[model samples]
Target: MNIGGRALLNGIMFQSENYTVKARYDKEGNIFITEEQTPTILDNKFVSFMSSLPFLRGIVALFRILWSVRKIFIISFILVIPFTLLLQNYKVINDSNINELTIGVQYLYIVLIIIIFWGINRKYGKFHGAEHKVINTFKRYGKVELASAIKTTRISSRCGTNLVFIVVVLKLISLISGVNSPLVNLSIWLVAYEIFELQETKLAFLSKPFITIGEFLQKLLTTSEPTVYELKPAVEGINHLIKLERTNN
Candidate 1:
């Protein structure tokens, strides 16, 4: 069974084809686990049809992920607006340099997002590391126990961080080339997803540059070496997911 997951503020979430599980720690230091049916937009015929196509499938997948985290995107947008208005007041963002301003705003928005995740939500990187390690352990050894997962790498080739890196590079290229249209941005995501998937194929060597930068970024900012205590929820969530998948099979 293929598995994907995300790190939560105080824990981890793992999703399989049919089930989603979240294992978290409460303020009282107790561990709690919750399971639910996995949600998908593929139930809609139109979305399912699009997901069967090539480049469009990548776009659909991207949309699904973004929708799952819509609240974070909404909050980030709201926070950036005030900063944008403040920049406008200072005449730092003017019509004559709108493209450059857009690029600057995008960078600032990323900074704000990192600050939000790292500052307000403490231990986020540790949980993120734990999530990756558990997934890696499952893929490598078909095990999700803490002992096995704790020894695995925290960086995954399939990570969204790599996609983010590709998108950022594409966006910069578009801006520099004076082509900042919405369609261009969508195409960038399509191409980025293609490259992201290529990393798992025989042509993976071609993506070494992107992978190198992504791994560096993951190590530097996105993930921290988590303690065994921090890894508990991730292991529990993935183990539960594996059991659910096996039962269904």
Candidate 2:
């Protein structure tokens, strides 16, 4: 799924639960590709399993990020009290009151989670940025170039950060009816998938907030500027994928 692994460095391996591959360049101009299968979601909590493995770095562990665990929990920290408060505040959902204490807890939780995510970014952000550029370039032209990739934005409509932002928005809507539940989060993802998959169509304007949040997170937490060498691998890797896909078809 990480087509951008083409831009990554040689030592790192890209692995998500679905598929894993390592792309490397040799002195003879050959592209050597290696792959592995990750464990099932049933094996462990998705994010915990992803984070538990020291073998994965960069975008490989992206989907398994702390914010990407179980659906709505992506903003689990920020909405912890908010969720409970939202459900408890209304008569139908429950019988309780929303107070200043709940609001304060939400802000405190936000700061705490931001610190955690920012710390993770400090380690793998360069590759994260490279991944985004390669993905954008490949999506736009069906190929990737180091130069064009370097000029591309680190933000993408398909970014996990954007998905998280959208989830937060949807969760807010659920508060009106006091349906604070994970099942709502699951349904949100189904709709979100269409939004992301069809983002270039009318979904583009509808998904603007996701793109905006993605850009902000790219700047603040998920990505760092990439170097020429980093960009080179991505270009090569993506070109390899293009060639391989052509051959397979």
Candidate 3:
């Protein structure tokens, strides 16, 4: 079973093919677990068809993941528009250079996301580390115990951080080459996703630079070494997800 998860403000969320589980600590330091059915667009015939394609499947999978967090994107969009208008009014962005404006806003959006994650990391980094550790333990040893998880590294090659790095690198290349179009954007994502997948194969060496950058970002900005307190909730979340997957099978 492939397990994936994200770190929450005070805990972690783990999801399998059938279940999404969240284990969090309240203000009183009490841990609580919640379960929900996984919501996925891949259930649709059209989406499933698209997911069967190669390059297209990467975009489809991306959309499915993004759809799960649509609310956050909506909120970010709302915030971005006003700030963009503010920049325009201040002459920070010239409307005549649409490409420049678009790229500027894209950078701003990336910055906004990073800032938000930085804030989350202030209190949640340990949980983030625990989340990666637990997943690593499960994948490597088929176990999710705290001892095994603690022994695993927090850095994960399958992390969204690597994808982010690839996107940023491609964007940088586009900017340098003065090529910014819808087609280029689409190609960037497709290529990035392909590179992401390549990291797991024999040609993984080719993606080592991007993966290294992602690991550096994870260590510097995203995750902190977790203690038993943080690992416990992460372990519980994944174990619950494993149990659900087993029962369903």
Candidate 4:
């Protein structure tokens, strides 16, 4: 899977890809995405409940996206900082205590495991090279593309770096809280951040241009063609182009 970095950093766009999903663009500047999967949390019941009251659900979703940045101190405080503080108050050691591996073999094994996991994630996960290529492609277009703007893109300007910063802050909060269990504090933050992740994805899709284009094109094609007998000459030209497209195909 590829996730966009540019959207997170510059607030220009958000891009992502999954092997199970696909996106494509058609003529007339439309983009289409396949394998869309909406989480159950965003079901009709939740949306309807929120819609029953004005601004409540909208406000909640908006705040969730902001919290994903992890830089929003208020969100961090509500979700993460308190746990960190609790850890600090309990004298939790956030740093790994396994540094005392006097055996060179044991230390080497730990290092190897870290390297292996890093390699695996880099090769297959959201931070892979494919995402970078997609982001670069999107940047090249002025929010437009010829073939399919929905090229698999995983580049994210916001999620990774901001999430790391959030984790670091949470760790510090745990230290400040005097919590003896840094791992526990980290776990709490991770769970809270997962909620933020889902919300961010929804917002990203809504703001995505390629997706918008695809949807618009789908609607356009589905609608009936208006009578154009008066413009037969233009129609002939369009037919020629369409024939060319078919021939090329």
- Provide backbone clash counts, one per model: 0, 3, 0, 35
lDDT (C-alpha, whole model) for all candidates: 0.82, 0.58, 0.85, 0.37
Candidate 1 TM-score to native: 0.84
**What lDDT, from 0 to 1, does candidate 1 have?**
0.82
Q: Which ten residues in a row have the lowest lDDT in candidate 3?
A: 38-47
Which scores greater on lDDT, model 1 or model 3? 3
Estimated TM-score per prediction? Answer: 0.84, 0.57, 0.87, 0.30
**Residue-level lDDT tens digits of model 2 in 1-249:** 344232244422344334455666577755577654445642357545544443332223434443235566646567766866675665424324344444444456556666866875776676667777877887787677788898998766666666666555565565545554455655665555545444657658777767777678868887778777556655655565555555543
Model 3, CA-based lDDT: 0.85
Once all C-alphas are superposed, what RMSD does model 3 give against the true structure? 2.6
Point to the candidate with the largest TM-score. Answer: 3
lDDT of 4 by residue, 28-98 (tens): 43433333323444434755576344335444444445544547676656876677577657756345532
Off by over 4 Å in 3: 44-49, 79-95, 109-117
Best by the lDDT measure: 3
Error of 4 at 104 (Å): 20
Query: Which residue pairs show backbone clashes in model 1?
Result: none
Error of 3 at 79 (Å): 4.7
lDDT tens digits by residue: candidate 3, 21-79? 99998899988999988665545678768866779988886786778789998998999
Shift in Å, residue 64, candidate 1: 1.3
Higher-scoring candidate on lDDT, 2 or 3: 3
